[model samples]
Target: MTDSGAVLPWLVIREDDNGNRYRVGRYATRTEAEQVADRLGARAHERLYVVERVDRATA
Candidate 1:
């Protein structure tokens, strides 16, 4: 933590059966990320996650 005090962007990702993380997409808002996560979860047979991605702006 570099004390940037910035809100990072969100990402929607899927962890397949092979334990590989694949980015479904990136969103500017958490709501958008969660929406995509819901859609993917419905069809996903493996793990799905909505997580914050460290933005370059903060770096």
Candidate 2:
């Protein structure tokens, strides 16, 4: 987050079998977020991880 409290553009989200979602982290680029997500996803047995871009206009 910035001083203005703006959220990062890239998000790493984790979802569990129960359909609960959590924000793993935020990044300035999608690639960075995806790398983190992929790393986490590899060790997850029943969970899911995804990377999404947060568009400021729609946010």
Candidate 3:
């Protein structure tokens, strides 16, 4: 859970050099999500990792 004690809504997304994007995972805090992205990015420099809040409107 996040500091605010809410459901995890932040999402980690990976975008490849080929222009493909997909969700990696969800975290309660942005910091946690970023850390995961950083680790993934370090292992695969060819792909790009990013963190974003879940868009309930689109869901």
Candidate 4:
């Protein structure tokens, strides 16, 4: 769960380089996220992950 208490559908692509995390896109399903991750990971040498994300919002 995120700070906003909402679970997002899917986080498509995430890249971590030098301890910096970058969110690329969000998808409707995990399968879709994984597909994009596979393609991006093949080209990117940095740490990449495709997973679900919880929505976070400042209150």
Q: Write the per-residue lDDT of candidate 2 for residues 1-59, one digit (tens) a residue.
A: 66779668999999999999998988888888989999999999999999988778865
Q: Using TM-score, give the best candidate's number.
A: 2
Model 2: pairs clashing at backbone N, Cα or C within 3 Å: none
Q: Work out the TM-score per prediction.
A: 0.64, 0.81, 0.80, 0.63
Return the clash pairs for model 1, or none.
Answer: none
**1-59, model 4: which lDDT tens digit per residue?**
44666555678656578666677776666777888888888787778766765455521
In order, candidate lDDTs are 0.71, 0.89, 0.88, 0.68
- Encode model 3's per-residue lDDT on 19-58: one tens digit a residue: 9999999888899999999999999978999999977665
Clashes of 4: 0
Which runs of model 2 end up more than 4 angstroms from their true locations? 4-7, 57-59
For residue 23, give model 2's deviation from the true position in Å: 0.5
Question: Model 1 misses residue 7 by how many Å?
Answer: 10
Against the hidden true structure, what lDDT does model 1 obtain? 0.71
Off by over 4 Å in 4: 1-8, 55-59
